[model samples]
Target: MSLAPRVVIVHRTTEYEELVARHGTHGQAAFFLGSRGRDIEEVAERHRRTRQALAEVSAAVPLTWRQARVERADLDRFLFAPEDVVAVVGQDGLVANVAKYLAGQPVLGFDTDPGRNPGVLVRHRPGAAPALFPSVHARNTGADELTMVEAVADDTQRLVALNEIYLGAVGHQTARYRLGLEGDGGVVEAQASSGVLVGTGTGATGWLRSVWQERGSALRLPHPSEERLLWFVREAWPSPATGTSLVGGELAGPAGLRLTVESERLTVFGDGMDTDAVELTWGQTVRVGVCGERLRLVG
Candidate 1:
């Protein structure tokens, strides 16, 4: 007989929990929020709802299957098995947070609070887990293969994300690097700017959208299921030493955009998680492109 699949339920610590931890007590947390003209009950209610939803999802796991619970902060340390089914019980961003860590596991996104969340990735409610879990385990469910972005450094450091990847300096200062696009002739430009951002269709609805809006209709962004990637150089500074000719473009097929670090130190982070970024030194090259591993999202 085949081994039973493990159900990994993922969630993040809510604002109320964070506040209480920081303040050392619920009353202190309430007082802190009150001073800011905010109500602690609002945060507590959301937290309560999220916890309740998590409990419901957990209870829906099959009796024969192994179960695991992981917090967002512990995802980096979690070991996901090949036969594991991931159930994310949080907001849409939580789904993105957990995507990079997964290989090709089917993910079921659960929205604890409906109206508050956009329900883009987390489309289902907690109650749906009872029916959805069996379908997902049997591989009889419909799933969307969402594209993801990846960044690989010369040193073999690799990072993948569902939304986008950011490469820039470690501090507030401008990042200096040489940019080149594969298959776009031998042309390359040295640039000084805020940094570089490469994203997928899923990312277009997030940070990539802001950059697209700023440039009007310069390039068409891809959809969530499109097998393409978009890249943009933020605030490309033109000076005697650097050129701004290579600002932005699309990456398709086997092509990738390359950035060679010229600054003392640079960082590559994905999905807005700056603390877990890869560090790069001068003379190091990092390539950004569409990732081969797609997020198998079960609707």
Candidate 2:
């Protein structure tokens, strides 16, 4: 007989904890809130709700299965086995953070505040967790398979993104790179722009959408589950050495988008998190493509 699936709850730090960590003490946090015309009680209440929800979620897990709790900060170091049924007890972004580490495992997203924070990814509440196990365990759970983007630099550092990947200067300065877009026939263009954004259909409504809105493209944006990817070179400038024609397009199939670093320094980060990024020096090449792994999100 097969063993029970282990329930792994991934949670992030609460608002109160963040305030205390930033201010060094609860008293200091209160003072800072007061000075900003904010009530410390609000933060306290938010933290209270978060903790209560987490407690309820923990209690809801059935005793038949093994359970493990992982904080968001420790996700990178956590080992997720194939049999693990991952549950995220935080905001929507937390689901994205945990998605990259997973290898086709079923993810349950529980929002701490479902009223104020209605999430697309984290659609379920803590109260629903207990009832979800049977279906999840039987592998009969309804799920959305969200496409993810991957960025590989010099075949050394590789990072997967559920939303979008930003490739540019660390500070959003002008980024210089040889932009290569793969189509029926490969086309490479030397260009200077703010940066490049390679996003999945899951990210169409996010960063990619904003970029498209600003530029007003006639092409249709990708749907959440689409295997295709969209690339946009922000503010591509016209120079003697740089071409602006191939600023944006769709990338699919084996040959994806490639970037040869021409700037003194450039960094590739995913999901708008810069701290976790790959810094590329001049002449380094980074490839952005669709990640084979898909996020099996149980709504």
Q: Where is model 1 poorest over a 10-residue stretch in terms of lDDT?
A: 212-221
lDDT of 2 by residue, 23-108 (tens): 99999999999999999998898888889889888888888888999998888889999989998988878888888889999998
Model 1 reaches what TM-score against the true structure? 0.98
Once model 1 is optimally superposed onto the true structure by TM-score, how far is the C-alpha of residue 217 displaced, in angstroms?
3.4
lDDT (0-100) at residue 110 of candidate 1? Answer: 98
lDDT of 1 by residue, 226-248 (tens): 98888888999999999999988
Name the 10 consecutive residues with the lowest summed lDDT in model 2. 179-188
Residue 222 lDDT, candidate 1, scale 0-100: 96
Cα error of candidate 2 at position 225, Å: 0.9
- The CA lDDT of each predicted structure is 0.93, 0.86
TM-score of each: 0.98, 0.94
TM-score of structure candidate 2: 0.94
